[model samples]
Target: MTTTTPRLTGEYAIDPAHTRLGFVARHAMVTKVRGSFHEFEGTAHLDSEDPGNSRARVTIKAGSIDTGNQQRDQHLRTNDFLDVPNHPEITFESTRVRQVGTNEYHVTGDLTIKSTTRPVTIDFEYTGSAVDPYGNLRVGLEGSVAISRKDFGVNWNAALEGGGVLVSDRILLEFDISAIKQK
Candidate 1:
């Protein structure tokens, strides 16, 4: 017997209602804080015949960051952090996509945050593909990458009374994407 995988070749737009662009960071060297960007849009062009030909682009509104805390969310948009008024958008543009495993891909891209651009790679697992109730062909993927907050010029922290810093330098970016193929 032989089996074949379904071709996922098409231009897809990310469904914000089914996608999550979140981040996790350590706070006070004790616990972790998680947040998600509520306003973002992305698109992907997948070439099943040549995975390396795939491409992706995303733009996140810096002012839409939410942590479930009104005060903290406001603080995050200030000059001490995102500086939303100055750098209103965070963006990512894929430079290359390579398959490293049967269902895993390493996507290397340029991530721009607060006017600073850096190269970052995320390892994504192809979760699955399905047809939604709305009759849309959808594809799912999950990925995460750890990066230094300071690398993007987001270096505002206070010293703890006892030890360590108020905020961790390392941040973990997580993605749960559901993209619908465009006709």
Candidate 2:
């Protein structure tokens, strides 16, 4: 096969093995904590020529959160945080996709966590594309968005010894995606 400009007008599915759904938040007003959800699936329809016509959707399992520490990860699943039992899934559905600059996009959508839905905009940069050994066309992208945990009904927190809280109110949601074009 000859290498050429990657097509951005087809449907694609996120390759879980090459994608990461993660987050970062301040811990105890000092350090930062990073974690990721191991289970998720997403798809997108690209229309590079008409970016506004593009769309994407994703669903993540709340119980799949991994923070390196088992105890803390479990705690996050409790009512104080994710309340995974009550809300088994976190989801996002893009309402608009706009190309802001060369290979840059602003995706505005409704993000639902713990059954509460709110609008958010995630800025993404298209990393590039390639054809894998198996003849699969893949596209890469990285993006992130900051959001308030409290707004998602995850109001759990504890006061630190000196000042501030155990976890920061602001959370950074990150996405590293490698999507394979669907035939």
Candidate 3:
């Protein structure tokens, strides 16, 4: 029998319905454009007692990018941006996890996009945990990290008539995770 209030440890799967894998970027050097991937899967091995033993992995379908704009979404999948046809997925693999403060952690991982990989460290906060109606132990976490899109081989831009570029170089990756305990 599974305990309703189990400790946050062991393997778990990220619940897609309750999770958000999104990104934000400055548009026209003035406003921000937000979008999220509609398809992704993630898993984690949580060791709350010894954070160093914790790790996570995620895979996002590149073509699943959505910004509520059909034309723009299609363009984003071209060679100028994600090039989804060539690179169908973006992935992350945590290399280290450390507890920084109460219910807070820093996760350093290798992020791959468009065949380019870079190390990124994201700060995550534990929101809370609960046992759902299905008797599943769920844990909540939120995190974000900023990265230069050019660094990931996503260097596409349009020059503005006045100044600056259409899309900012830095892109903020966001994560809202609700994971179900598997063990």
Candidate 4:
């Protein structure tokens, strides 16, 4: 006889319009280049009483990268950076969630960029949960992670006469996501 597993309920899908997947990197050793993913999707599954059991996944379309400059965005999608033609998407899948405080967690996951999967940890915060005006159960989450661009094969650079590189290797990822519960 086949048995049915109990439906695991706290399912939610990311609200793409309201969610932001942003990144910041030092530019020209004097400024910062800030950009966001224009197309992405994510989901969250959590237990109301025990958020430690939560699971999450996010997928980002490489071509949707935008920094408010069309030329720069195109360059970023080329071989010098994301190489969108060869690597269509970047993805993250949580492997574990460790609660370190009342509302803080270290979310460890596998982040795949340009087909290379690496382990990453994000400092996460569960803001709260609420029922929106549309009657959808929603949850808010925020997190940040820092990673080296070179680690993901984006090694393009230019040396400046002043002795610094045109870009910094470290990139900071920031996320403010909201997900609507599944019926």
Q: List, residue by residue over 65-97, the lDDT tens digit for candidate 3.
A: 999999999999999999999999999999999
Candidate 4, residues 1-183, lDDT tens digits: the string is 001122334788999998999999998899999999989998877664555587889999999998999998999999999999999999999988877776677889999989888999999886877778898977777999999988988999999998999989999999998889899
Distance from true position, residue 176, model 1, in Å?
Answer: 0.2
Off by over 4 Å in 1: 1-6
Error of 3 at 57 (Å): 0.3
The residue-by-residue lDDT of candidate 1 on 1-183, one tens digit each, is 001143578899999999999999999999999999999999999877678898999999999999999999999999999999999999999999998887789999999999999999999988888889989989889999999999999999999999899989999999999999999
Candidate 3 lowest-lDDT run of ten = 1-10
- Candidate 1 to native Cα RMSD, angstroms: 2.2
Range of the 10 consecutive residues with the lowest summed lDDT in candidate 2: 1-10
Measured over all alpha carbons after superposition, the RMSD of each candidate to the real structure, in angstroms, is: 2.2, 2.7, 3.0, 5.3
The per-model lDDT (C-alpha) reads 0.92, 0.92, 0.92, 0.86
Given candidate 3, what's the lDDT at residue 134?
A: 96
Q: TM-score for each prediction?
A: 0.96, 0.96, 0.96, 0.93
1-183 per-residue lDDT for model 2 (tens digits): 012242657899999999999999999988999999999999999876687888999999999999999999999999999999899999999999988878889999999999999999999998988889999989899999999999999998888889889999999999999999999
Q: What is the lDDT of candidate 4?
A: 0.86
